[model samples]
Target: MKDQITHLPDNADRSVAKQKFKITNWPTYNKALINRGSITFWLDDEAIQAWYESATPSSRGRPQRYSDLAITTVLVIKRVFRLTLRAAQGFIDSIFTLMNVPLRCPDYTSVSKRAKSVNVSFKTFTRGEIAHLVIDSTGLKVFGEGEWKVKKTRQRTPSYMAKVASGS
Candidate 1:
């Protein structure tokens, strides 16, 4: 069957569309935005105490300076920002110094090693109520030769579309 695709209007203005939607809870939304912008690198006293009271290594290896909680925190930050291990290490170090936390920050190597066996669990936020989430995506227009032309000239499958076509 022929593709039943319809193109969007060329005159559509994103700014105008955005202006149409009004925020109901501006204060709550603003607070959430501000909180999201502020990164909490240092753990509170209760968290640090809990980490200290937890299990310790029984094996006769090098004693770790930073606890599992600290390492896990670094790993989570790394994952959220899509940073390299080295970059994550630098980030944690900077944050620690800025916050004036007297805790030892783990090296990138230690974070990498500990991350292999770390169990990061996220708590469920729903209070026995069904929640719905909506996600929208838009395609980016690439400024290059069209796929058909490139494929014909190169006499090979285009790399961009190869994965979907070949299941790779």
Candidate 2:
């Protein structure tokens, strides 16, 4: 008396139900939604004051115009925004223009030149705790047996391979 099922897989009876997320807190949820699209940009006065390098006698070629801090700041911003050198220069100029700061933005060419010598150290967060890093040994040459030989011959994998695979 029942009709035969032509597409058995198309039926949802065998599939698990998808999860349903319901927001309980209206005020907190609304505030989080509003904050998601908001962006805040701020630079301290100390950094602004140190933007330009102090005039000093140079023994060799040409004296530096912008300070190392300025170069590092531009480079950091560029890296964070994934912007090109010229775009970074324009971004810095726009910020200064809007902020009414009298400082001049560094040129793209200058940034490119100074990048080679400037040592920019990026700060990494380990969730307020010391982070341990493990080095990968896969590319490293193992003294005993080669991976291809062991894999092809169906021999037991070495401990180093296991460690590399587990990333420990």
Candidate 3:
């Protein structure tokens, strides 16, 4: 079963207290997530030096384990599997020893924020009819804004909380 976040503390204070993330019955979620993961085609910046030079240096100091290739691999796995951040986090953290990833898996926020930074453009592959050749494109979209409809309405659906977090 997937996780669902129905409501959140709209104005939760950060420094006042902390709510740690934990996953119980992790064996099942671990198997579920990993079984769903796959290593398919990948897109990466080939020119590492050039790519690094293009971005501003972080003030936090030298690169950390967070920058390791294994992390990127897992990020791709998460993407290919289309798992949410929490699912990935729980899944990976539960099986760190088994997978032997260098760093303990990052929490959902870290994984989601880092991967979500890759919103620049998308690369697509399409094939033309009656030909062996294929077409590739990126950043494809149709956009419209400032539109409203009175007849169309939105409704919220009810959801049951998963017992994994023990009702936190």
Candidate 4:
């Protein structure tokens, strides 16, 4: 039966071959790498024109100063940059000043109050191409006493690890 043996006796031959990939388009690859770390800011003319309230005055409370579109636009900038309401206000104001767009930015209070009613629409970054997303998570022990303290205190509680990811 030894002569008819069909399987290898060792796992050395069962190992998978390492994959080798070639980057054929160096210019595109380099541009993509550079863009990964780049930040872009854009403001269209239509947004500038519709910055202030255009609707007829309501027969109720004080008339609104900024339009819903303006509030939504500022809120979106806040979310994207992870900035405070005040900071977002200043940031947008700076952008307008630099672009020479004579549009008034909504204050933090106005933006916050209008946020409850404004329908903010966030657009996905897709250029008519299939986007492949890769997500990796790592758990980290953030809070808790040391192991020696736990042993001495006789309080062996389960530790909770926090998972943080990039671009999250």
- Top TM-score model: 2
RMSD values for the candidates in order, in angstroms, are: 19.0, 15.6, 20.8, 19.7
- Using lDDT as the measure, the top candidate is 2
- Tens-digit lDDT track for model 4 on 43-157? 5455556567777895998999887667766665566457999998999788779868787789999988878776544443312221111111211112222323457789744
Candidate 2 lDDT score at position 115: 85
User: What's the lDDT for all of these models?
Assistant: 0.50, 0.60, 0.38, 0.59
At residue 161, candidate 2 shows an lDDT of: 22
Error of 3 at 113 (Å): 2.2
- Decide which is better by TM-score, 1 or 2: 2
RMSD of 1: 19.0
Residue by residue across 24-128, what tens digits does model 1's lDDT show?
999999997776444333245644453322556799977766655666666655654569888878886776577676555578888788776655543222222
Model 2 regions more than 4 Å off: 1-15, 24-30, 124-168
lDDT agreement of model 3 with the native: 0.38
Candidate 2: lDDT over CA atoms?
Answer: 0.60
Model 4 Cα shift for residue 120 (angstroms): 2.4
Clashing pairs in 4: none
Candidate 3: segments with Cα more than 4 A from true spot: 1-65, 68-71, 100-102, 116-168
